[model samples]
Target: MHFLQHLPHFIGLERLDASEIRLTQSVITTLCGLPALRELCLYMPSALARSEGRPFPNVHRLELLDGFPFPTTHDIVAFCNKFPNLRALASSAGYGGLLRDLTRAEESSIFPVLQEYTGTLRNLHIFARRSTLTHITLVDGFLFSRLVAELQGVAALPNITFLSLALITSESSWFDGAQIETLFTLFPNLTELQLTFMPTEPDPQILTWQINGSLDALLSLLPSTLRSISLKLDLSDYHDTRDPDLEDDFSLLFDYPHFPSLRAELMAKCPALTYILFDGYHFLFLWWKTSTSSVWEATADYYADARGPSGAT
Candidate 1:
């Protein structure tokens, strides 16, 4: 509390990360006075039940570290109202555990101009239709059937331009023709996507080869507007397979036989596609120039790009 009192001394402070600081009335009070603060990451306690109504118009991004207990309707709305210019909000895994039975009327009042969000899919509908959320990252993952059921009650989000979904499948449930169309219909403006898949069913009849068979064909069905795509696989559950990077051989999961065709197929299908990536324990990044293509070996810089402002997956 004493240290925070001195914080306002720095008139040019533009970013404040209070993830380790406890949530207190004094903390919020001090933050409200920072006119130049553009980003804030606050650690919220689960017991918080109400909000301080003051507005922070300059803050464009807010992160609720270790997301507090899903707040009540009034509490959540009031909390969001504090940041009128908040364009991006990121929450920890704890935030989206439950569904808030907010009425359409209540949903429309939240996040008036929010454009980017990173949270669970369960809570996406809360802001998707009303807000201009163009960049989204569903950190907790998603299922096609569940998403369909959820979207039935709400409207499709046509403003989404960048999307990242984590998928957990038993057999090979990653790709489907209908799913691709549904995604495009939901986010017609989508240009960048990142997909992460994890296999749950041990010793399933279908192998990685069969999955790629669908991948080769289904990828062609993706929206032509897509310019960059990233795919990551987590295979720790299969046949005592260890981390892919630690393993000497990876032929079982990533096949050398089909790489060329898959790459070529994607390049030709999406004429505007500029970047393609296969990231996991092993990684490969490819980019297309005017008439030629180049490969980027795995590097720390590539990982940063995947999570940077322009690309979030």
Candidate 2:
């Protein structure tokens, strides 16, 4: 990492792909010295000390490969304080503690980092491992509601244009139709969104979500600014046993018979949406903007080419 010092003109630095490289305070200080550094990616280990009183004035993008052991809210606050101009922030959860920290934060003491970028930050992404949610208590719907509340707090992100969150576990609660609507309300200016949901147990009764309305109600909740969206649903854990004959059957794995109608409704309700990707039952439904007659046609063709006639393996 010392070589970075010689390249003072460097505008971007990414060492996340290097799993062996552990970032420490001194290395961070070295990177901060770069006069033009605008982006940085690093793998931060737990308990790593942070430098004080130095801000990355030019940096607008920051990505942390591993969730830093933010020992306290002050640590996260201090880190955000250092990147005053940050426009995008991405973090991976080493455990579920990060989510707990964000959700449990008192309303009076919201995430200071997000508050810092309330006007400038345009993109936010959080990916958590399944083990992270294991410690949380699963009640009627407390855990899911808490998670949603944490996201809702981000309504302060009035200028945010993109958001992605992938936190899946067998015990995690599903986001029913109402929760989905609340999500769009929280990020009203979002131009793109991506989400993944997966449950752990094999209880057929518990795995499937019971949305109150048709898919149109869910799709209509999207903000007018949204141009693209991706939803990945993993229901493999719902089955008690795997049948060899149906192992390769995609349609039998998950049920969404109204998918075609949903696509049509989406096009009608959200004309700005140029693309939609829905993957369920191990089947993929993709749509892209083109000169084609219908967006659904494009999605069907893409699905057919990718999955073949059976559409599942």
Candidate 3:
């Protein structure tokens, strides 16, 4: 950590990637002294919950790769308050309950920490993963609702342009078309979006399933400014059921046979969209725009040529 003392002299250092190292008070303090440091990635230490350190006024981007101490909301609020100019933040959802608190209808006091970056904050990445079914049920919907509420509460972030949310859970209803629409409404300027939903079966009652809606109806709700989009939906559970009507609906809505047509439809509707990706059960569809073409060209000459042709299995 002593080497960090010399970092201030390298005044030109604008980005620091310390994801592989454990951060300590001494190390963090040393790095914060760097006058030109604008971007930093490191783990937040439990000690930070008690430390009264100087603010990183110049940092515009900060990524916390690990969970903070217990009561993560307080720690996250402290860090957000410390970095007044942060434009981008990436962290695990387990460590940032501040989002949930902000959306609470009973908490009337404004969050000064988040208010500090309202004008400059533009990107947010939140990732949540839980292997146990009990734990998943305890936090998945609650966290997601809080996220939505937080976004609804913050009306000052008009410049926000990128958002990514990845979750591993057993709840299929955690995010639906309505929720996606709500997200678009919250961040109207978003140009890029990525969503990965990995569903696990914890009990017979809880299985991954698709939301009821046509792809066109969902895609139409996206902002016109969107230039890139990546979506992964786990629909493998749809085939496990014995009901014929349910299977028919699932096959008609999201089966691989309809992807090429969906691709063409999406490109025509969203002229600014240059990239689209869909990865799921028996489906790996990708499309990108090329020069001299207003339409999206499929990655493979034919969908079947890309991989051995197969139906929803």
Candidate 4:
């Protein structure tokens, strides 16, 4: 074990098809020997539903799977502790839920344990389901309120630097708007952000979100040092949902007056902001098609010059 220790910094345990408890044991053995390991990605099998607490102690980069089989609050908390020094985390689990659950849990809950290692954490990337719930719609106001409060409570992590959130269709509107607001308010040190929304129309229900909040809320929440923003919006409401092969129609949302709030806000609020990219291929196509010829010509010339050899040709 000692001879093979320094082989590499990343250790991936995937598709072993082992049970949760047994897999946990094997993982502990594999990771304990590699004290210097910094990156770890665990792809659990369908049957393996759980793992013991603190699977690793020094991992600086961690990625854990979610979806398919929903990850419970305990599973996430335990995983966080496994990497005490993790500065970057990209997970497929319910990241917002993990944060929310950690907050709502009692003082004796796993959040305190996570707090113990918060100093080493920096970038967090979450990919989970998104809901269409509105701010004014509340099932239990106190529950969500506490979740936000807890997020704000830890928003000031001294070492955190970047955050990326991908909200799927399963989550309510709360994740994109309110949850995002709470996150930015707390973590002012963030320098980069990537927010992606994937709206799906599954069987049994055909729900769509109509966001009433101003895009200003999104811009206002970002830190002053933020430098870039990337949005992937799937606005298919205006299209025929009945058509199985219907392509996403994002034009309606892109033209919304509030859509440019971020750009305007960045220009006004964050002087450090310099780069922006909008993905939503169809939307871009339409934008290019509708733009003035002068503007297009200028952009083409600028790119040509930027990539030309020694300013020639």
Expressed as tens digits, the lDDT of each residue in 89-169 for candidate 4 is: 444343444444344332232212221121111112111100110011011112234444434424344344544444454
Highest TM-score: give the candidate number.
Answer: 1
Error of 4 at 154 (Å): 7.4
> Whole-model lDDT, candidate 3?
0.53
Ten residues in sequence with the least summed lDDT for candidate 1:
304-313
Candidate 3: worst-modelled 10 consecutive residues by lDDT: 128-137
Best by lDDT: 1
For all predicted structures, in order, the TM-scores are 0.80, 0.61, 0.60, 0.46
Candidate achieving higher lDDT, 1 or 3: 1
Better of 3 and 4 by lDDT: 3
Question: lDDT for each of the candidates?
Answer: 0.66, 0.50, 0.53, 0.41
Model 1, 120-141: lDDT tens digits are: 7778777777546789888885
**TM-score, cand. 2:** 0.61
Off by over 4 Å in 4: 1-30, 45-55, 66-83, 94-161, 166-189, 197-223, 236-265, 285-313
Candidate order by TM-score, decreasing, is 1, 2, 3, 4
Q: For model 3, state the Cα shift of residue 209 in Å.
A: 9.9
Worst lDDT run of 10 residues, candidate 2, spans 130-139
Cα-based lDDT at residue 158, candidate 4: 30
Candidate 2 on 181-206: residue-level lDDT in tens?
76666556677776666545534334
Model 2 alpha-carbon drift over 4 Å, by segment: 1-30, 45-53, 67-77, 94-143, 151-161, 165-174, 188-190, 200-216, 219-225, 236-250, 253-260, 290-313
